[model samples]
Every structure is written in structure tokens, then in C-alpha cells.
Target: MKSERLELSTNDVKLADQILESMPGFSEKMLQITQRLLNRERQHGRYIVRDQLARGGMGVIYTVYDQDLRRTTAMKVLPPQILHQEPKVSSFIEESRITAQLEHPNIVPIHEIGVIEGSSLPYYTMKLIDGEPLTNVIRMVAREDPDYVRHYTRHRLLDIFLKVCNAVAYAHSHGVIHRDIKPENIMVGKFGEVLLMDWGLAKYVDADDNTAFEEAQDSSQIIEHNPSRTEDGVIKGSLAYIAPEQVLGEPSAIDKKTDIFLLGGTLYQIFTHLPPYEGENMIDVLQRAERCQYEVPSKRNPRAQIPKAVERIILHAMAPTKDKRYASCQDLIDDVEAFLAGRRSGGIRQFRVGQEIIKAGDKSKETFVIISGKAKIHRSVNGRNMTIAEIGAGEIVGEMAGIGQGARTATVTATEDTETLIITYELMLDELRKLPPWMEKIVFSLADRVRINSGYLHPLLLENRIFPLVNQLFLIYAGAHVQAEPDTPISYPLKDVVNEVTMNLGLDMASTTKVIDILAEEGLCVNVAEQLSIPSLQDFALFNDYCRCKMDINTGVKKIKEIQLTKEKDSCFRQIVRHLHEIDV
Candidate 1:
């Protein structure tokens, strides 16, 4: 005996739906029955549904067998109840079309797209990937499973991130933006194949396609239910990882940077074992997303030992504003690859004593970090060079000029043999661009202040004005030391010298120390082990006379004195006075 398949006509199905709607449970049961009858009737174009593989907000993925092609495949289809809804139908069809257009290896290939026979429901068959979603792998790693912990090292996770970047980059090249990028949508195959799944929220920027799903306003719709996946006609993306613009519901803000933000969020989860945003519920998470409020990856999970370079990349990509984010996936890829390769954009420079590291009025956009030794910052005022500040190892210089993007405001010279890291403007801009808009504005303002303050009275003049007290203190101590030899340095306890200067001149220890440091820099005094040593009392006396001469010239006090000295002493004194006279004090 031959079996007969029962089929319902279009009107009969509609009448049954209306009748079932009158009863509560009957509607779902009847719809399932009708779906089964339709499947048995036409068998969905020779593809038999085997078992449900996966399900997402948009559709259900089933393990289907192709009778004609004689192979197993994955078929994504919408629930039969939502078939008549136009927005859902349009979104589903667009997703199929977009996925079919992107033919990258990391992106699942669409094998066939067709409507089910005897109905308007649509489905698409894709290559069946033998893999689990990245969400599963992340969970396993988070639990610290012995196998996962040993296998999924930081390097391995980064490799997965790079593969995803390649796919996103390829898609972006074709003018497609994956607005729903996250770990849940990333499928990691058992054999190291990483595929970016679900192009359902992808936007076709090259075309004016308005069929894209709208953003959700209600947080309740997205909570506690696949919070990692985006839904159609509700939330455009997962609340935990969506960009601020996505949470703001501005479709115009969606661009390449938006996808970069999502990629950053995914990378954050890889190391920190938590999404960038977290709260008690979806509303709290959405608020955090809107405000871009989240602890940095380093503070979020210190044990992860997140590399500083990788953390910078994440912060750059997930910048609060889209303008601050990487402009393209390729730009992000370059940074990630650079970090992985242990490369830096900064160059190393070695400067000998008295070599100029930076010259004022020069148009250069490089900032220097002192790696060893010390340098002096000086600026020219009225054709006279004045020392502005002293910078030693582990200090940064020229950043103000770099941030201001203008001519160098001051000159920097190595006082001793020095090494520095020269950071180019391009690299500085790359990192500075990641700052929040307000913070960036503040940084620019500070740079401007530094540049403008060069015209004011310098602090070196104040140090010079207090130079007389140090001279008097030295003279007092030198006279009292009757045991001092002719060429030997006269030593005095540093505290005693500071106290003597402060007691007589009403000066603080810091002021006295500044004067002492100036004398030390000029080689007149040597400081060691809480003791001040004058290398030569003759040289010290000569420098004191030079200070008096400079001060008298500024104060309009005409005083002349005749002095005689040896050739070596005269030469040394003249050289020191010449440098000091450049300050015009």
C-alpha cells in the first residue's frame, strides 16, 4: 500500500490559523502540524530537515540533508509563525543576500537560497561547519578547565582574533559592516578554523538599503536571553559590547568604526574573561554602554596579565566616540600584528654630551623619552637662552609641541651622554586619538599653556636671584674651615649649609637646594653623601663675582672691579660666565 501525504491549501491554512487563534494552545500545535504536513508534502525542494543545529534571534539553523546533491548541510529558516511579518521577512532575505555576496573563507558560504515549496517561508543552506561558537570556547576558558587553560593561551586567542579581523577587513573592503560582531557570533572550528557567523545585522553601506533592522528601546526585551546575540526589530546588537552610538540608536553613527568597537569588545572578553560592560541587568549594561563606562582591561582582571600593547589596541578600538576609534579594520589589524611581532613605532636615538636633542623653532613632530642620562630644556628670550627645566632618565620631553602640532617652543640638549626613544607624531596621534573628547581637549589645552608660558618671566631668574645667598653661605663656611687645603675642596654638611642659608635669607630648603643644584650643574660644587664640596674655592669665588656682575647689570648698578687669575682659571671662568650671561640676569 502507498502512503498519502496530507496538504492544506493556502485558504485552508489561513482558516485554520484563525480558528486556532480563538484557542490558546491550539494555535502553536496546529501551526507545528501544518509545518510538518508542508515539509512532508514538498520536502522543501529535496532538502530534508534532520535535526536542529542552532538557533538565533532571526532564524533556526537545522542540520539538513540535500537529497539531490547527496550531502549534509546547514539550513537557516524563520519560524513559520513570523512568515507573514514583512520586516522580519525582509531582514531574513537581506541577511541571506548579504551572506551570499561575501565569499570569504572565514565567512560561511551560502550554498543555496530558496523558498519552501507550498509556502512563502524562505530558507538558505550553507556549508556545515564542524565547530562550536566562540562563546563556548570562552566559557570553557573562563572556567579554567585544565584542557582549555593549557590550550587557549593568550597567543592562541590572539590568533583567533586576527582571523576574525581578516574576515571583517575583507567584508569592510566590500563596503559591508558587521554591526553584530561578538564572540557568540564567532564560530571556532575544531581544527582551528575561525568563522565570523551571522551577517543578519550587516549593513550594505554602498547601497541605500533601508531594510536593515531597527534599534530597540526597551532593555527588558534583550535581558537574560541570549544577551550576546543581537535581535531584529529590538536591539541592534548585544548590550554588553555594542558601541555608544549603537546604544544611542543613531543608525547614521554606524560605520567601520562601529565594527572596530565591537571587535575591541570581543578582544576584551578574550583576556579579561568578561565583557567590557557588565551590570545587574540589561538596563544597567545598556546604561554602561551608553556612557562608555567600564574598568580598563588591566584593572578588570590583573591576573590575566594583559600585555600593555594589546590593552592599548583594545582601548584604541573601543574608544568612547567613533571618531576616536580605528578608522578601518586594517588599521586595527596593523596594531595587533605589530604588538604580536614585538615591534614599536618609536626610534632610538643616542646623544653625546652637549648634543642638541631638539631645537626651538624647528618644525618636528617627534617627542622624546629620556632612557638614560639627563637633558636640559632651554628657551631663547630676547636673544638670551634661559634654562627652563632639567629632565633626567624616565622623563618625557617635546610632547607638548607634539600634541600642539606646532613648531618646537624650546630647545632640549643632552647635558650628559643620553639615550632616548623618539616617538613619531603619527604614533603619538594614534594613541592620543583614543582619548575621550573632553580629555583630549584638556591635553591640547595644557600643551597650549606650555607653549604660551614661554613668554613669561622664567623660574631660572628666581633661582638666579637667590644665588647670592648660596654664595654668602659658601663663603661663611669656607672662611670657618681653617683646616682646608689650597686645592682641596672645602666640605660642609649639606643640612648645615641649607640651615645657614635659610636662617639668614628667610629661604626654604627647596630654594637653597635649587641654588646648590645650579652651582653643581656648573661644576663649582659637588654634592655627595649629605655633604657639599666646593671643588675649588678660587672657581667658586670667580662664579660668585660673575653672578654679582650680571645682577648689577640688570639692576643698573655700575660697579667696576679689577681681578687677575691664571690662564686655565680665567678660561674656565669666562666660559661659565658666557653661558650664564645668556640668561640676561
Candidate 2:
């Protein structure tokens, strides 16, 4: 079945024209929403221009309706000035032709390319996407949550950029290079769909073609000798997103990683809400781009506190030397996925004795967990060295800042040859969420301990929270002296147990035995002579009551500690304990 499209009134066209006119640098263009509608109708047989979407450097975009097709479409019409420019005209045509061949869900589809009558330039129509450019979203975020820009931006940017990479990777596989990729050329839809736009500078990867080879050779020379060619021509990509090699005109040597660099730059801007490099003019920006070294995103945005994995991804992607960048977009994507999944994205380098693993007040990278060997935490007090704590194998150091303000509270130095597993705050949170409920309780308990004690305990103690809880819970129900054979059925011992309890409730050997005796006396557990077992619950009321008591006590203790440490009221604490007693009794 065909869908129907609506026709627009003259007033609607006038309103659209006014809207386009109000935008930056589009006022003088010959923009008529009505004219655009008429052109769409003439070209496609029947369509209507609903409104102007946006104006770009070379053209104006309008949202239109195709009456016959019953679908919304975008009309990209070149302004007269850009149409007359021979290079731009050729570029527009090439972009349309190239984009039409790209068929990916993440790449907007180009429908048709033609010259509107009475206008000497070419115009193209594409699927009108109902979304905002990625740049706009970043801007909105900057306005709303400027404080946590680093954390939020990195997540959002990585997500969108990964989709961008998937699209560009598909294009590359099809032998196309989108020489221009910037935030302005990316759109994120309401339903989380991402589309890569503007293939204007797209070039085919055919070495056998004489003209292409010659063009490639020329571009290579320009890239090698001139680092300022980025300012020349139409400047296809945003000045900030131009790769260093691209800024130097090295299009011939530009391979997949070149796009990776642009992807990194675009992500950097999105993540930080600021470009990697900024300048007052095109030349200045081009020079900074050519230098190819900028402050890491974490350094630039104090609130950003980028995870080490993300920092590594960005820096590697933006490596000035092509060899230093990721070998392929897929490699970059894999690391990003690893980071998002809360795992080690890659290996960590070993640090020498006395080496500064992390510096105080430096927020560049995330903390590292000692996989092997030992390290010492240091903080200077009154110009003297103070040993805050020593971290042995399996201990996580320098996470205090990462979880909170992201400022290093102290410096960590390796005391011996060490192999540390580095994790970012972003990755940690993701990983923590995936843990089972029992595991989560242990982890949160450890985190709470760290927060309270400030890393004073042995690393082994930190790692034993969950195991200890499980062991203690079983021991409590089975009786402290009860022993089971290796092949003994777990249900036989626990079946008659009464106290619905867990290790989280500060259960110890003695207290656990007392609870078990209470359960036995209460008939919650079945004692067949010397053997102990939990009773089968036809109605889970008793089991539910016991479990609720254990959970309530554990939660209450945690809250009380928090209140005491924070110097807050104990009213909430007293009220909880009072409620627990009433429920349990």
C-alpha cells in the first residue's frame, strides 16, 4: 500500500524560508520553501516541502513529503554561489553518487540526484531523518550537565562513534572513503539510531584508475609537504575534526586509520564538549592539527575523569603516526566494547620499582589494581614523605578519585616489579552491575570498607568478602561444629535449617551457632538425632520472614555506619532497628 503526503500552503513555505533565513550565514541564499516544494513535485511527480531543516556550508536542507511514496524525505539543494563553484558542484555530484551506493542502516540513504530547472546547480534528496545532529546533543548536554561532562559525554560519544565506525567501515569495505566525518555530519535519532552524513569528499579506492591514482599522488605530496591544505578548498570536514595527515594533505597514504583519527577527533569533541584543538582562525586550527598533539580529554575536562581504557582508545585512535593508530576500525570498536562491558580492554605495561604509577592531583588516567607484586601509596605532608598505605597483589589502588571527584588523593609508586590490571571508572561501574546479587553484596561491602578505612586492610581481606559471607551463612545454618562429607548433599544439611540468614549480617561462628539453636528450638530446622536439615516450605512464610530479618539487620548496620561516619542523625538508624525487631519477633 502506498502512503499519502500532504501539500504545503504558501504561508507554510514563507514560514520555513524565514526559519532558514534566521540561521547563521543562510540569509542571502535564494531559499523558498515553496520553490523547493515545486521542484520536489516536478522531479518526483508529487511531493511537498514541509519546512527547512537546516543550512550548511554548501546547501540548504528541507524536510519534504513524497505524496506517491507516503514517506518523508530531505531535499538538499545547493545555493547558487556553491552551485556555480565548479569544485563544489563536482563534489556535490560525487557525494550524491557515492552516497547512493552506500546501503547500511547507519548510513542515511541517498534517494536521487538531479539539477532543479532554472537553477544551474545539482541537488540531492535523502531519507529525512527525524533526529538532531550529534553536535547539538553534546551542546545540550554541556548546557544541562556541565559538571559530569566527562563521564556522560564519553558514554554518549563512544556509543554514537561506534555506530559511525560501523557505517564508515561498511563504506570502506565497499571501497569508499568518506574524506569528511565530523559531528555535524552525524545524526542520532530518537530511537537511538545513528546515521553518518555528508560523503561529499568521498573518494574511491581504485589504484588502477589513472585519474584517481594521479589525484592520490598529488594528495600524497600535499600531505607530505603542506600541512595547511586543510584550509584550502571547501574544507570538507570541520576544522577541528581534520586528521593531522589530512590537514597536511596526505590523502594518498590515508587509509582506514585516517578515518579512525577523524573518528577519534569527533568523539573527543563530543566527549569533552570542546574540540581537541581550538584557534581563532582556520590557519591556527590547521597548525594545531598538524602538530597532532593535544591535551587528553580527561586533562581538558576536569569533570570528564575519562576511564583509562577510553583514554587509551582515544589516544591510540588519534596517534599522529598512522602506525600508532588502531590497525582497523574493528580493533577500536572491540576495545570500546570491552570498556563498555567493564573488562580490561587490553594489556597493561609493567612498571619498574620506584616508578610513579599514578601522580597526586593528576586526573589523566584511572587507577590500577595490582595483579602481582607490590606498591606503596604516598602523600606529602609538610614537605615530608608520608606512607599512607602499602598495596600488595590483587589490591586496587587510586580508585578513590575515580569513584568520586576523580582527583588523585595520593601518589602510588611501584615498590617492586609489578603487573597491574588497569580499569577505568566507566568500566568498573559496568562490571559491578553484572555481578550476581551475592557477589554484589560482597563488592559493595568491600567498597564500603575501603571508603571507611581508606585502604588500611590487607588485600586478601578485601577479596574475601563474598566467599566469607557464603561460608558463614552455610556454617550458621548447619551448626558451627557440623561437618559434611565431600559428597554429602547440600539440601540434606540445609533442609531443616531455620534462620534465614546470610554472612552480610555480621554472622560469626559463635553467633551463627546461637541462631541455629534458636531455629532448631523453633522447629524451623529438623534435627534427626545428630543430623541437621532445613524443612521443606509448602508456604514460604517462615523462610520469607527469616530472610527478611537477615537482610534488614545487614542493611541497618550499613546505614548506621554511614550515619555515624557522616556525623548525621541516628533517628533513621533507630527506626530501622525498631522495625526489624517488630518484624522478626
Candidate 3:
């Protein structure tokens, strides 16, 4: 078999230069790596390399079309110099083996692995994603759309980082640690797709306890490179994104936090368009990374104006010690989501309006509450407009749509400059579960109010009197029972009862009051302490049943009279039934 050769292009050189220029301290190293990649392309005739996708210390990535597969694929080939080193070659093989086991959407999917014929050099092909490196994208956005980047309020940057965390977290769960995570390794596609690339330095921390043959293989490779000495070792990762533990040459000591540190460094670069530290030599860079001393992300990019939540995420992820950082990538993901939801280390937030609020049908990612302004709720019906209810301050809207309900029950818009407490479904459920008993009660109460208002107004919109004053009176009486004390007389002020009936039942307060007064004058009700109640115990029982049955007021009065007459025959049963009804109702 002969080694396959491919041709390189001027555009590839230019792309390599652009990447190197953007990564200031790594310019010389990247250029050297790119030259080696070009040399490899000239040597291998099979892979039709189109453009350089990325350049790193270990290798150069190219977007190539696989003639057999008939689809574009990303090919990462190690440079001859690195491949010639036994340790580096072994590490590359180990990474390829480990990554092949990982199957996730956010991770760049590996297709196949092949070795250049007549040589020990290995290369792997993966799905070729059409996207910009997050590093370049962030830098472009920072320079051109600083305002949008800083104050867009969408936290799109955080969302992308979270997806990266999810991928790394998944890798961690599978016992693989991405030793090198930098901005250039993350790809952001046109349709908000994020792919984490470059698992070349990924290590299986648990592979140590495997078979003796595997241990011998790894040990032999390490011995060949004599990596025990600081400068003699293969240095398997890029200096900039290397974790402090890795810089200390204690690769075994590096754990999940190492990934966290790298992710934090990536975030730092994304926001500032600069690595945390810049130095002339790898030693200085490694020393600074080991020391973990750098200006805060906010200070580095004054225009970035990062939220405290985001700053905290970087700080925690980049904690100097493993114990200080998050326990896992999932923890970092949680923090990122919390930040995007506008929740940091603070008390639970109440709902507000004017924030990008979404209702049931809205596909938007935000949810909102009506804090201080009024919002009208409407549901579309038969191509006709129907106002369900009017929401005021302290009311929640958009929950139905947000909680996986495919469509919103109604649409809500801010009637004024409302301040809504915004949250995503993920954060909202978390916060809701942690709420105090009183908060739960308040939320349910608001929901009930919305339901009641919607039902009442829906009929009104159709010009149909669905709930008359008699029906409204029964609902008020039933509602009062829940709040009333057992064996205690519950009273409603004449004016209050009248107002409730008129507003909810679409009747005049005067008409409502007149009906109530007639009942009192007939000895069916009593006025005690300026509050209305049933005078006779039997009458109260009859009224309770009538209210529960949804009968007309006049019919309910007649039923009460019939019950009173029947009670005249059995005194004890009537008294007991009346008392039981009063307590239960």
C-alpha cells in the first residue's frame, strides 16, 4: 500500500495565519504545526483536503470530502514530527479509541479511523460541520456587535457554553476527560447548533485499573518519550487551555475540575477575545495557568458587561483548587442555566412583565410574570377574538406554554412597562419546588383567580349570560366556606356580597342587594353584626344544597321552604343535618 497524498491551498495557509494571529502567543507554534500539516498533505495522496479548519500543537484539521462516503468529513491528521514520537502516537491512539465510544449530538461524531499506509501515522474522520469556531465568532461579535453581545438580554453566549458543558459533562460521565477545552474547539453553526470538537487529548482516567497489557502499553510509551522530565515529555495538550494540575505535570491528578478550568478559560477568551495570560514562553504561560491568577472576566472586557451570574460561573469553573470549583460539569451547566434565567445567588424572584415573556403558543424561550402592570389574556377560538381574562400584578402568565404545553392557553402582552420575573422552564420548576408553603398557596390562588375570570369573561364575550347572579352568589358562598372557621358563623357584608354578585354575574349591585334584603325580610336569612347569614339552621342547610346544585335563586328559595317543612316532622335529624352541612360547607 502507498501513502495517500493531498494538495494544500493558499486559502488553507491564510486560514491558518488568521487563527494564529487571533491566538497571539501561539503564533509561532501554530505556524510550525500548520507547516507540518501541509507537509503531511503533500505526502498523502488520498484525502482531498479542501480547507484548513483549525490548527493546533498536535495537528491540523481539514475539511475533506470522502469520495467513498460521498459526504464532506473533517479529517484530523497528526503531523509527522508528533507522529514519529512513540508517546504522542500512543496518546493519539488512546484518544481515538476513547472518543469512538462516545455518542452524543453535541460532540463531533467520529466516522472512521485510518492509518496512512506504509507509515504508522494515524488519522480519523468525523462529520464535517459547517460552522465558525466559537473563538472567531465571539471575537467578531465582540468587535462588531458589542452592544448586542453585552446587553442583548438573551444570554445566547451562556446558552452556547452550557451546551458545551453538557457535552463535556456527558464525556465525564463516560469516564473521559477532555484535557484540552478552548474556544477554538467549540463550533457554533448557523442555526444555533453547537458542536464540541477536538477530543485528541481526551484521557480515560479510569483506564488505569485495566489489564496489565494496557498498563504496559501506556508505560512503555511514556518511557520512550521520557515525559517525566518537564521539557522532555510529549506535553499532550496546548499550553493555553491546560489545567493547573496538567501544568504541574501531574496528569494523573487532573480530574473533572481540569475540564472545568479549561472551560472557564474558554469562556474567558470568548468574552475578552484574549486568553487569561499572554507570555513569550510556554514556561511563563504554564506558570500563570498553574498559579490561576488572572483579572476577573468583567474587568478584562469592560464592554462585555457580563452579568454577575456569568462572572460567578467563570470564577467557580476556574477555581484554583479542584475543591473550590464545581464538583462536575453538570454543576457548571446548572449555574449557566441559572444565570441565563436571571437567577444568581439571591432570594427567589417574583414574576414581572416587559421582559421577553412567552405565552402558551409562543416558541420563544422566555417566561414572564405580571409584576406591576396589567396584561390581558386571550385565547383564539373559531377564528374569533376572545378575551379570557385581565391579569394584574402578582399574577403569572406563560406557564402553560412554558411547561411543555405545545400551545399557550392564552396570549398575554404587557399593558404597561411591566417588570416580570423571567425564568426558563428548567429554572422555574426548580424554583417552584423550593418555594415555601405560603408561596405555593399564593401561586395556586392566582391560578384560581385566572380560571374564574377566564370562565366568566368567555361567556360574556359571546353575549351569553352563563352564570347568573344566583350562580355567582353560590360560588361566593362556597369560596367563603373554605376560609371560614368550623362551627363559627361566616358573614359577608351586604355591600361586599352585592359587589361580588354584580361584577361576577353581570348584574347591578342594586338588584343583588334587593334580592338579599328580600331573603332577610322573609326570615330566610339574618343580619347579625352587619353581616348576612341564614337565620334558621334548616334554612341554612337548604341554602347550602341550593347553592351547590346550581339552581335559580327563586327555585333555591322554594327548595329551602320545602326542606324546612319536611324538617318539621323530624327535629333531631334536621338539626344534625343542618349542623353537619354548615361545618362541611
Candidate 4:
């Protein structure tokens, strides 16, 4: 008979009344039972606690009726054991203060905070959401029914995600961070309403150091014959989506980026129909979060058919290291919003084999991205048109004119009937505006370099056109690998590079291999004797040196004569520009 557990169920209350009418010597017992029932129905300072909705380690949530407001609401009450500690008690009450201050559309509002009569437990009333949590909504994404997938398409899912970002961004603005951000903690209303729930772990950053968010949580495990202590190396947030710093317990390191990691994790789940990391139990999940291991969306859910841009966005957003993630919630929102906008850009157009999609020395205002089939790049040199490259789906054509001057330098003919995304003049402008500053600079730099470097590089070297293309890959790898794994060869597996290049880089394996071979021959890269990677830091250094020398060599040289931009060069330039804009910077 634990007093703490002595609460009556709804049916128990009704049973007591029926038993009281049949028994003669139990009036006192009936009086006690009746009093308890009356207490359950009685207003706790004008709040009628109707039923228990949920319970967690921190508190119990109940459906309550607010007499003053004349409406139903949800109330969370801290258990007595937690209230026994004043420090814990203060922070528990602070939850309401912090949440009530955040007047965001997505954050659930707090109506009142006080102790209920006949119970020492502190409680706060809030909006009672009439919808399922995001966990249930996310499960709907993985359902076998085709209609569920159709209705919750990637766009629709991301649209809901943007609203979550809106609320988190608002919290950050008010010197607070919602340390625990997960699907289960979010409410997705039946009518497109999204509410950020549970500010129990939310922390207020000092106004002085804007970057440092110091939210606290007493996630302690009980120990025999000793004071409770938080689990070592375990973060206070949800294990499934906790940031690396949070797992490491780096007090100063927790900030906006910590929230960004959680945001990315949420997006990752939305795209893949799985958590970023999964394990058999809580400890296992916590360990995985600390290690920061996860499969990309494609591997996690192959049928999801997540776009490369979308996948890349989620991965970047969820980078294990804080600095590698987005700077602010706004940065993450802007990027996801921009990627969503680009996916919606331009109408799809179809082409037939041997069709001249673009031609050299001809003025073309439109740029095209192949959604299906293939195209060939050819250039006119001395009196003949020679084939330089062949590209398939996910490749771009006519971007040279889209980025810089209107003159098209290369001829691109469809290798077969193809479907393309035609971005003409104005639409191109819209995508360009959405590009991050670094990406804008990269595109502008490439367009300028192509304009300047094309004069010296011979169109005949087929490898020469490939050089410009591969250099971007090398630069991206050099930066990326060094950040993620400084001692490794930047992941130079032949198959990995080939598939990634073909799938996203808009380059075929044949051309990609040629460039890889040339890079190897130049000593800028070397395959490890018994491994798939290249030779470590030295190779990346060499690759960087070679890129610098090549840029200098081509950029410094002037045209031998008034050389016209060949169709191949023009196509290559446009391809680069399109790629730069389409993917993450």
C-alpha cells in the first residue's frame, strides 16, 4: 500500500459507489471513497483535472478543464520526489516561465503555473492539442499504402518541418534552445497545424554570450547508497537525435548548432522513415548518437527515392560535429526552403535522339537539366565537330549562357529521347538568388574562370575539359574529408566516386575514370596499395597544389587569337554552373 500509487481509476470510483449501496457497515469507507472522487472532480483553483493523458520521468500530463478560460487544456505536474529538491523544483517551474515567454505559433502556449490543492505537485496548464504527435505522422510516411506516401510527399513533409524550424528559430532569438527536438515531441494537427511540445529540457542562454545555450536537465540514474548522478557521457536530450556535443556534455559547446543537429535529425527521419541512428536499447542509441554513425537516406529507405539535393541537405544539417552543421536555425530553414524552391522550379521538357538541344556560336537563353535519357557534348575544332563527352540523367546543358554572356559555346544533342528541366532566363534568376553566398561565389568564380581559362586550354585534349570538371570534385573532397576525417585519403574508392559522380555530379563513369587516371598520373592522387582510399593527407595536399597551379596556368594565359567558345567548352561551363547551383555549397 504505497500512498504515492494510491490513485483511483475511473471504473474504481463507480464501483465504490455501487458497493456502498449494498454494504451496511462501510459508510465510513464510502465517505472516504466519495471524498477521493470529489477531489478528482473538484477544481484545483479553477482547473478541473479530468484524466491522465501521459506520464514521463519528469512529470505527469493530464487533460484539464479551465473554468476561467472556459476551455479544455493539457496540464503537466511535477511529481513530489522531484519537488523535494529546490534546485530541481526551480528549474521545473522555469519550464513554464520559459515556455510562456516564447509566444511562437508552433510552440504550445502555457496558460497558468501553480500547485494544485491537496497535492504539493507543481503543475502548468497548456493548449490541449487535438492531433497525433509527429511520431505517428512520420510512421504514416512508411506505410504500405500508396495514398499515404502521395499525401505526405517529400515536399509536404518538408513544409511541415519548416514550421518546426520557425518555432526553434524563434526560441533561439529569445536566448533559449529547445535541447530536445524530435518527432515524438511535436504535434501535427489534422488540419496542417504543427505545435512544438514539451519545453522540459529547454534552456535559457545568458544574454551576454549569445552563442552559448546553457539549458540544464537532471537526467540522473538512481544508485544504491549514494546520491543520484547523471549517467556519464549521456546527454540530457533524446538519445535518437541528440547532438555529439550534447553526448560529450560540453557545456560551452551547446548552442544554436546543437539545435541544428536535432533539426537535421528530424529531417533525416522524415526523409528515410527511420531515425538517424537506431539501436536495440537506450544505452545503445545513446552510444550511437555519441559516435554519430548513420546511413544516408537512400540506404535507409531505398524506395523513398529521396533526391540527392534533399539528401545532401539533411546530411549536412545533421553533421556530427557542431561546426560542420548550419550556423543558425535560420540558415537551416533558408537552405531547406531554397532546396524545396529549386525542386519546384521550371517545367519539364522532352527531347529526341540526335536533336540539337543547344549549338555553339548560337545565342541560347535557356539552361536544361536532364531528368531522363542522355546527351552528347561536341565541339567544332579546325573544321570538324568532335565528340568530347556523353552525359545522362541529372546532367545540365546550356548553363554557360544562363550564368554569363548569352552566347552558347558548345553543341549538345540528345543521345536518345530525354526529359529535361528547362530553366529559362527568369527562373534561373530565382534559383540564383536562393543560392548561398559561398555557392554564388563559386558559380561566379567558375563562370569567370571558364571565360578566362578557356582561351589557353585546348578543346582537343578531352582530358583538358575534364580537368575543370574534376577540379571541383577535388576541392569539394579536400574540404569535406579534411573536416570529417583528416587522416584518411578523402574516400577515393573508384566505385564510390564513379557512382556519386554519375548520380549527382552530372558526369558519366567513363569520363570520371579518365579524370581520376589523369589525376593519378599527375601524382595529385594515388590509390593505396591494398585499400580503396587514396594515400592520406599528402595526396590531398598534392591535389590542392595541382589545382592552384592549374588555375594559375590557365587563368594567367591570354588567347592566342580571338578564339570562339567551342560547343564542348560552353556545354562544360554550363554543366558546372548548373551543378554549382543545384547542389549544396
Ranking by TM-score: 2, 1, 4, 3
Question: Tens-digit lDDT track for model 3 on 308-394?
Answer: 556677888888889998888888888777655545322234434543234545565346665576776655565555555567788
Q: Which regions of candidate 1 fall more than 4 Å away from where they truly are?
A: 1-45, 206-226, 351-585
In candidate 1, the residue pairs with backbone N, CA or C atoms under 3 Å apart (3 or more residues apart, or in different chains) clash, namely: 216-234
Candidate 1 lDDT score at position 169: 93
Q: Model 4: per-residue lDDT, tens digit, 22-51?
A: 897699876778766555444446787799
Looking at model 1, how many pairs of residues clash? 1
- Using lDDT as the yardstick, the better of models 3 and 4 is 4
lDDT of 2 at 577: 31
Top TM-score prediction, candidate number: 2
Candidate 4 ranges with C-alpha deviation above 4 Å: 1-44, 145-147, 207-234, 343-585
TM-score of each candidate structure, all chains considered together: 0.53, 0.55, 0.49, 0.52
> Could you give the C-alpha RMSD of every candidate to the true structure, in order shown?
17.9, 18.8, 20.1, 25.2
Query: Tens digit of lDDT per residue, candidate 2, span 368-418?
Result: 878888898776654545555678987887665545544565789999998
lDDT for position 392 in model 4: 91
Off by over 4 Å in 2: 1-45, 145-156, 207-236, 345-450, 453-507, 510-585
Q: Give the winner by lDDT: 1 or 4.
A: 1
lDDT of 1 by residue, 1-585 (tens): 999998878999898778878888986787789767655445346888899987765799999988767789999998787887887788788888988899998898999888887777799999888988887788898888878766776667888999999999999888899898999889988889888988988877665545343555466565654446564555578777988888777666678888999999999998888888877767777788889997999899987656677789999999998788898888998988876654565789999999999998899888899999999988776565666678999999988777786788788999999999997776665455344435656988888887787556544344454445646765675785656565565678888888887677654465567667666777888888988887766557666665565445344243435456678867876766565444433
Query: Order of candidates by lDDT, top first?
Result: 1, 4, 2, 3
